[model samples]
Target: MSQPSSRPELTPRFCFNQTALRDFLRLSRSTIDDSITQNLNALLTPSTTAFNPTSTSTRSVTPPSSSRAIPAQTCTSFKHNVLFPSWASRSDVLDYCAGVATSPDPDDPDSVLRQIEDEKVRERVVDERLDPYSGRYFPREARTESLAMLMRNERMVEKVVRARTGSVVGERCGEGGGLEGEFDEWRRAQGSGRR
Candidate 1:
């Protein structure tokens, strides 16, 4: 019998399919609801893997040192689990409607219940969008940010500022800090050279 080749053959390079990649990342198509919200970085960030856990890649990522706690009432809307009068239990509402709908000739029970359930699901989805930390589905276009997009933009700004100024002393850049200075310098230099 002929002997097999000692070296393994390499495969040709292939392009990444972003749609497939997002699906693999557990981000569904429904996640892109609004134009302002769905930017590139949101698709690439691995959800539920905030920090690297591998032994070789372990690194310390400290939380903010401030001890202040965010107030719970800061959230705009409150949903009480037990106290919400509008919260109808499926059985109670269904049983009540059962008598009204199927009786003689009034209405259809299943259609009404289905419509209510659909509305409830939509309401829950909207509520989920309000809670960014929940990891519940928020379509990209619906909000101005996904956690990853915000992180990526912050990093990019930091890198550019660091590159231009070579200064790491200041806190996060303010609105009209070195960034505006750098831009003005560039415009001046360009104008001077044009003459």
Candidate 2:
């Protein structure tokens, strides 16, 4: 049996071709549209609509009296109860919450201790794994390049849509009555504007 070499193998970095990326984005328009529709439906659909008491009940309901103000401790507890579970997935957030709950800092008027705790939580959560530019997480360069290409594709799609709808200016402006004429017109406009 041959032993494997101990040396680490270096792989070539893959760079995206702009044209191919644009084409891919154009082809994935339907998927993007479906996602947008799904997200919109999710946002529009009320979570509590089915359990709405007013819709089911025929009896007249009197609003509760607010003569007595809610206790500060009760209000704080209620707020914590509603909010803490949302951060349950994150350990850093849970640690911050636990620290805040345990430490009752009344001496510091500016709440510097709480701010420091918050900063610590932020630092813990925003490690190298969360870094967008770090190649350690992925073998790619900056995400901004992908974003720029996507934006360019979106602009191209928009231009195509406008041309199809006859909404684009000088859509039939060229001698050939196409994009060439529009380019010629744009060049002439630019030349005239320089003077």
Candidate 3:
């Protein structure tokens, strides 16, 4: 047998597509339906109602003629929970957002979302969930996003001030303008620890 090479072979690694994971991170906790959350840890978690085969035969030369089943319905407990594409018709999504919108301020990070009276802006927010199943955001998403504005706005203000005034500002003596609370969660997710 030939001697083994000193260097290991370079090989590509594969991972699951990020479509679902993107939604998991981007989606506000409110958007996760209660029905799904209730059974999330169980062996057979509750799922939105869908029809037809969800998996496709990748071995085929061409795309499968049939499409994956789309969820037909979602949780009924919360008006803000939208898990399926078909769940948010009749302008319910827009209406829900409008109803929940708080007073907008220029310094608020969520001012952009709160100020979305234009149809184009609203459409973009609704369509960008990136989940194949839902691709939508409900009122709860708007609320959760708005709550995070305090920290986001602070960063933006500092950036703008530094650019125009040529001076740093908004110092809080080591306080991160509320970002400290997220540190633990972020670090945990990143899996960094003392070794």
Candidate 4:
């Protein structure tokens, strides 16, 4: 008979399937919840000082300075140990929601929440203009009109500035006909011509 093979047969390693992953996640969540509850309870309760067997003194030992006395009412919310959703547990999200709900400047037109709400309403109104494929809603016609209005306001301001200053600061020669044209005319009158 041939000698027995020196190398051992290879065996497949165990891998976590979807069910195993889910079960593990559930167990971990339960463990974390239990730990949090225990920690909170420990914080609320008064801790006893450890006995020093080596010392002969009869006086009671005091608790360490690190142990703080948590107020009873503060621990009430954590007493039930109900697990909140991830977003609800976040302090910033809670603060923002609270701020929006109890906004001091509710009547102010420039309030951030009011602005966001107005934008949301506008988006809803123009929902028909949304592109299904791209998932983008661009009211191009409205945007163009708004841009034109802004440019017109800018040109009007430029005209007023030209009239007040009598000299263009950074205005292009071809665009505004006020200061540029007048300056060119003055140069021609002086026999220097356009530079």
Residue 147 error for model 4, in Å?
Answer: 0.7
- Which pairs clash inside model 1? 31-139, 31-140, 32-140, 33-139, 34-141, 34-142, 35-141, 38-140
Residue-by-residue lDDT tens digits, candidate 3, 1-195: 011112212111100122332232224222322223232222122455664364454444653322221122211112122222212221132233233334332344454655563445456634345665554444424433443343244335433432321111012111123322332354354355433
- lDDT (0 to 1) per candidate: 0.29, 0.35, 0.29, 0.35
Q: Rank the candidates by TM-score, best first.
A: 2, 4, 1, 3
Better of 3 and 4 by TM-score: 4
Q: Which segments of model 4 are wrong by more than 4 Å? A: 1-141, 167-180, 184-195
The CA-based lDDT of model 4 is what?
A: 0.35
Q: Is candidate 2 or candidate 4 better by TM-score?
A: 2
Residue 178 Cα positional deviation in candidate 3, in Å, after optimal superposition: 24
Which residue pairs in candidate 3 have backbone atoms (N, alpha carbon, C) closer than 3 angstroms, thus clashing?
none
Give the range of the ten consecutive residues with the poorest summed lDDT in model 2. Answer: 6-15
Off by over 4 Å in 2: 1-143, 167-176
Off by over 4 Å in 1: 1-144, 147-160, 168-182, 188-195
lDDT of 1 by residue, 116-159 (tens): 66566567644446776654443322111222343344345434
lDDT of 4 by residue, 19-86 (tens): 33223333433343324434444444453567567665666466642244345354323322322221
Deviation in Å, model 1, residue 191 alpha carbon: 7.4
Candidate 2 residue-wise lDDT, 1-195, digit = tens: 111112112111111233543343343333322132232223222453457667666754654322222334543332233212111212232233234334443543345655665566556543566675533322233333444454555556644642432221122111123333433454466469789
